[model samples]
Target: MRKSRKLAVLTGVGLAPCLVLGLSTTPASAHGWVTNPASRQAQCATGTVQCGDIKWEPQSVEGPKGLKDCAGGNARFADLRDDSKGWKVTNVGSSTTFNWKLTVQHATSTWQYFVGSTKVAEFNDGGARPAPNVSHNVNFKGITGKQKVLAVWNIADTANAFYACIDVNIGG
Candidate 1:
């Protein structure tokens, strides 16, 4: 019985390292999100807005291409689709600067911003890997009033895209 107990203890000790190795300690990439105008996810990450699990990893909102929804077609982030959530609006001129903070850099195809179905601004990356930080001057010259801007980051080498919905009060 003592020998059997010793063997069991040794076996448990041998498997301890394997159990630890199987655990993932790497931080979630937590990727990228818009900060300047305060995307829904950004607001959550920064504690300006209260939300669900998205608040913990705002930069990770990703889905397939061609989704026009505010939540980037991610049901886990569906709160972003609520227009009455009282997301603070950033007042801006015809042109405003938007910034993206990328915790995980990826090759980018293009960056596009939209209001409803109308594409207001687009920036092409020419299939190059994006910098850790990206910013763009978005022109909405002819558009005015409070609007929900849908920002999309199209990945160059993948079919996935990240999304951000920014609430803005634009003045002509």
Candidate 2:
């Protein structure tokens, strides 16, 4: 069997210089996390915040379905569970748009939005692959002050779901 290739090297001449490409051989196990208003993982992924190994694979925070915790119960990313890690909080108005960045698109079962233990909204995809740029405008009209919204992407074909926690100062 051939080994999985995570990196591909390429060389160019004349008009362009050499370039290196990063690739994932495994398709089913990779993809996605909330972005807009910037989820904790998104911030680490972009260098806007410092973190551990999660900084390299923010889209890989997959844990079993129905889990309520961020980092998706993955120990390597347990830093995401650190409430005092100084995650940058984005100030926003009500009815905020939650954007998802997909590194590898896959069939999705549902998208859930939550504030603490309270589920604010849910969108059922019925096991359909999502659009390239996935986003949802969730109503936050009744919510106020500092809150952490947990966004979950349930994969249709797997027992796992990707998790992200977005810190926000709602109604600010």
lDDT of 2 by residue, 1-172 (tens): 1232322212233214322222424345558988888999988989888899989898899999999998999999998998898999999888799999887777999999999888889999999999767989899759899999999999999998999999999988
* lDDT minimum window of 10 residues, candidate 1: 22-31
Scored against the true structure, residue 14 in model 2 reaches a CA lDDT of: 28
Backbone clash numbers for all candidates listed: 0, 0
Please give each candidate's TM-score.
0.83, 0.82
Whole-model Cα lDDT of every candidate shown, in order: 0.89, 0.87
Model 1 residue 53 CA deviation (Å) reads 0.7
Candidate 2 error regions (>4 Å): 1-29
lDDT of 2 at 62: 93
Candidate 1 error regions (>4 Å): 1-28
Candidate 1 achieves a global lDDT of 0.89
Q: Which candidate is the best by TM-score?
A: 1
In lDDT terms, how accurate is model 2? 0.87
Clashing pairs in model 1, backbone N/Cα/C closer than 3 A? none
